[model samples]
Target: MKSLPRLSPTSYALLGLLARGPATAYELNNIMQTSMLRVFWPRADSHIYSEPKKLLSHGLVSEEKEKVKGRDRTNFTITAAGRDALAAWLAEPDAATHRNQAEFMLKVILAEGGSPDDIKATLARALETTRTETRMAIAGIQHIIDSPEAGVRKGMPWNGMAANLMADILIARLRWAEYATEAAAAVPDDSDRAAKEDIGLAAYQRALQRLQAELDP
Candidate 1:
């Protein structure tokens, strides 16, 4: 649809925001954390601020100068070029399979001998997040199935598929979290029994650091 380079998902999400309405950085941050971005791309605020510049440089989005309460706030708007680029990206065939990186699992594996209560807290928080995400994902599936364009073959079903997949993943995660929570709560602080279950957390952290170091350098 448009002559455009491959952009990261961060770039697409940013463009999608401007595709809807002109928004300041704060508004973009809210959208990223609250909507589709929350369900998929969990990114930093600084990254969000930097992407508009990249999009603007590529001539895919434009910025409007706006002032709020006497403070200069630049509101970004996606251009026709951006819409075209997004359409092309979506229309393009992407058969490449992606890998999963479960950072939370890494953290959980590393939480050996730390406070069991703290471990419980972490799992509980994850449980709540998983529940919320799964609910939103189900809603997305409903949206896709109800679309008038549902019968046609295109990129729309991908979101519905991903959303369903995420729902399943979240459900599995919640089940794991329950067992993890129970395990953490059941551990005796005076004993190193859990540590003996497998590789102690100290050993795991040391290995993690070495891996991190190797990757960093």
Candidate 2:
């Protein structure tokens, strides 16, 4: 199998959104929040401004100025290159590996300050979020599967495959959350040890932030 070119997940997501029609950055953000938040890329206002510029630089998308409510705004449309990129990504056999462990790690770090009640509350919230997200992902995928238009796509399976992948990820994460909640509940509350651990973690976090600033600046 040929290896695909490296593109951040956000890039492909923006391309996919543009495939539907031209849209301003604000509109894309709204669409993401309303419809794609559970099923697609992680939501960030940074991506709203950044990803399109990257796509535009790569010749995958084009921008036009339009007037809306007396102010000129830029609208982005997918180029042929963009569409091709999106289609290729959709059809690609290999699934991208995700780096999603940071969220779990963040919770571990924050456990330093959490009381037993706080832990229980946090666990309950985590479980609820996992369940709700999984449910939404499943429903979103099923909607596509049941839609008459979805069957007629050049490769119907491929179209559904992306949504299915999301559903699978959500389900897997839900299971992980269930396990994590039980394990967390079993741990004895040790605030002193947690505080010591947090001191180390805080140093590491500061170093990481410095590195991030250096890299991005």
Candidate 3:
């Protein structure tokens, strides 16, 4: 038997969305735009439009067309093979090499090359964005609770778990951004490089202690 082609993460994301029910690419894009999926696996509109076709070719999804108001509309639904693939993917252990690809995080990692003000501005932007996301996450959770029969609420325990995780991550990012902003503001003059190093070292030590406590507790 021929081995199946390796699917990209985007393919799996689309399959996961279809697993909920049939949806057009437009519907999938709308869901990604408005939900925690956007927070985790954001993709371009074009990619969303095209990935479903690829899944269909791979025999993982089936497509149907209907006339709605005299215009053809296409919807994609997960096939049995797609469900098995998604289940196997979910069962696989998370790759240890996985790293955050957030641009703001990249800037933070490279902040030493930039001026203090530049780093401070990046942190400010990140904090503001995270605050907005946190609000949306809270609103989403509230919506789920308010409308138990809504389509988005179909995945009972998993929906709640995913929403809670997104909210927790956003809260953690908000806290980190606040701390980094404060630390940037406290940077001493160039002449006191030692003091700056001390500040960075202290922050590192605090993080290390937190990890150690988590491991022990």
TM-score of each predicted structure versus truth = 0.62, 0.59, 0.87
lDDT of 3 by residue, 9-39 (tens): 8899888989989999889888877877787
Write the number of the candidate with greater TM-score, choosing between 1 and 2. 1
Model 1: how far is 44 from its true place, Å? 0.4
Steric clashes per prediction: 0, 0, 0
* Candidate topping TM-score: 3
Q: How far is 29's C-alpha from truth in model 1 (Å)?
A: 2.0
lDDT scores of the candidates, listed in order: 0.72, 0.71, 0.84
Candidate 1 lDDT trough over 10 residues, lowest sum: 150-159
Candidate 3 residue 84 Cα shift, in angstroms, is 3.3
The regions of model 2 sitting more than 4 angstroms off are: 1-9, 31-40, 57-59, 67-73, 80-95, 101-105, 109-114, 149-155, 186-217
Q: Extract clashing residue pairs from model 3.
A: none
Model 2: how far residue 18 lies from native, Å: 2.6
**TM-score-based ranking:** 3, 1, 2
lDDT of 2 by residue, 1-217 (tens): 4343579767787787788789888877776765544355556677667777788878889999978899999999999878888998888787555555446447655865656777577767878988887677667656755777732242345555666566677776777678667766665565476765675577578769978998998
